[model samples]
Target: MPRRHRLTPEKHLKHAPWRFTATDKAVLTRLAQYRYLKSLTLQKLTGRPIATVNYSLRKLFDRRLIDKPHRQVEGFNHLNAPDIYEINARGRRWLTEEVPEVTTLSRTHTEGPPKHFAHSVAICDALAEIELEVATAGNAFIPAATILAKATVPNPLKMPCTIEHTFPNGKHERLETFIIPDGVYGVRYPDGRSELVFLEVERCNPRNPQTLFRASLLRKTLSYRALREAETARCLGKKSFGVRFIGLSDR
Candidate 1:
């Protein structure tokens, strides 16, 4: 049986940059389907090497589009069990909002001598909503109007609702506060698939230290989560998934 997702509108993860790339879109699409993955899976899926996949994974984490879920079987060689990977809310949004809409020659057309950079606000807004959808995973149903309503409001910080968790045996080992709003959405990637992606938008500084630091933290957290979730599901014989991050820069 296929997996089902649950999304909410509350603010769980950070935002994706304005300028996401084509490769980035492909990666995100992969995650939207699987939810989690391993580096070897990605290499096989995308026909890339482990080094390239690792590098892209780092970049995606920095942009905050993906997160880790838990670990799973690692190597096919029987060397030992390796870690599993999962996708987060951000990656889902990119897949639905950005990737499928892309035409094969659109990139070349845009960069051709004619020079057509038709970046539309509607498109951006759509992407944002898609991102928001991924952030919520498949838990809830969120409408674009609701997001616009919140975005229009002046920093109210009021999501439709919120949820608090007490997972003593979980990794956080404490009461966790997860903002659960009505319009949240999130995406997951296939385990060890190359479709996982990273997107980054550079509107200001090409190298923002602060953003980078937060992104790193988010990635680590996401990776750990994917691994844990996978193990739990495997042990319990339940459907498992993972999360991957993508970064986008508009600059």
Candidate 2:
């Protein structure tokens, strides 16, 4: 009797159930990472043609794989506005099975008004653009897909430092808690160097500049400095990470 040879997955590809194309899965993984995207944004992320992106999105929607989040902005035309979408429950489950590398994202919920929903998606879209820039520039980029949701600064053993805020009248109070940052990812330069970026995208549009000063940018900076200080003290000759900030204007 002749010995039997093992069959390969490609050899059995014709008999297998339909699966998303590599592009589709890549786009889905990004959707899973970002939690929301519009068709235009999806095209940007996937580097696919606009028509292809739109058609694939429609197919995903038809299959109940993604959800369209509604916005409450007045005079907001859904057609004109970028439609917000996320992997629905079914989509999540499918991705977990197909792409085990992705740790499932927590279902994004909205406690704010629908307008805030629009802002959230806009912020994500902006970050996606930065990632596109890095990729197009021939640098290595790591999307949030592989990044954990929360990261502790100065490691688990050390406590984050806080500064005191002194008022003009001489009343001084300790600054409030530090933030964990919006996201962190690695970027490798073509020169073979890489750094983990502390990512923050300001989605808030101030009706005035006062709103900007009111936010915690200064305090956030100081907090990060403290983390760097802690690292310096804790380790020797280690390079430090930097913050990359991006802000969008209402106009």
Candidate 3:
């Protein structure tokens, strides 16, 4: 078998003022997925040390490729939380020019409280894990498009609502719609069978059986059921996709 051609900065890009390394290319490729990532997340995704990741990230930050959310202040009560980093316009352009493996470039920025910050980090972490796992096994892996409510693509998912009717047959009709998950992607196995997956990252700790039945988890399950039972999407030629929600929970 021929050797796999791993992407290298020198091979694809011109190294002038500052040199880009394998780790740098890896960072850019992963950021191609729409999400904000911190140094710890990058360390985990790239298998590099915290210092090394920080060094590379700082360089990228200096070059105007990445920036922390303007609102996040690294101070007391928020320990071990890496600075949230998102690719900027320059970063997007550089990735598009330097990396052929990166087909698209999208910007993801974060600006909010720390808990909310943690939630998004958890989401990126989950996606990064899947990307690594599938690629390691040589299976075909497609990263999901980032779900942004404000983005251009129209989202079909809607919040649960009640509709009133004037007729005596019924007082009202409960309108239900599926929830757009944190991420969505497809995976094709070697046997030609494939699966579309929906990922939900719950940063909160696991709840008890009783408590779990009413909150976000319950709503998510109902939405998944609605989508699957109703043929929300079709795959291949005849088979419709049944989304399986992979929940990533962290303390």
lDDT of each: 0.37, 0.60, 0.56
Question: Candidate 1 residues 1-251, lDDT tens each?
Answer: 64422111214324544455554555565444433444555555555667766666655655556653321212133235323344455555556566554211011112111221112212222344444455455433232233234343333222122112233444332222221111222234334221211222222223322232232333334333544443422322223423332233232
**Sequence-dependent TM-score of model 1:** 0.30
Range of the 10 consecutive residues with the lowest summed lDDT in candidate 3: 4-13
| Order of the predicted models by TM-score, top scorer first | 2, 3, 1
TM-score of each: 0.30, 0.70, 0.63
List model 3 lDDT by residue over 200-229, tens digit each.
766453432233224455556655666555
| Deviation (Å) of 117 in candidate 3 | 3.6
Q: List the residue pairs that clash in candidate 2.
A: none
Worst 10 residues of 1 by lDDT: 103-112
Query: Tens digit of lDDT per residue, candidate 2, span 181-205?
Result: 5655667898888766666666553
In candidate 3, stretches whose alpha carbon ends up further than 4 angstroms from where it belongs are: 1-16, 44-52, 70-83, 100-116, 145-173, 203-215, 235-251
Pick by lDDT: 1 or 2, better one: 2
In candidate 3 the C-alpha lDDT for residue 243 amounts to: 46
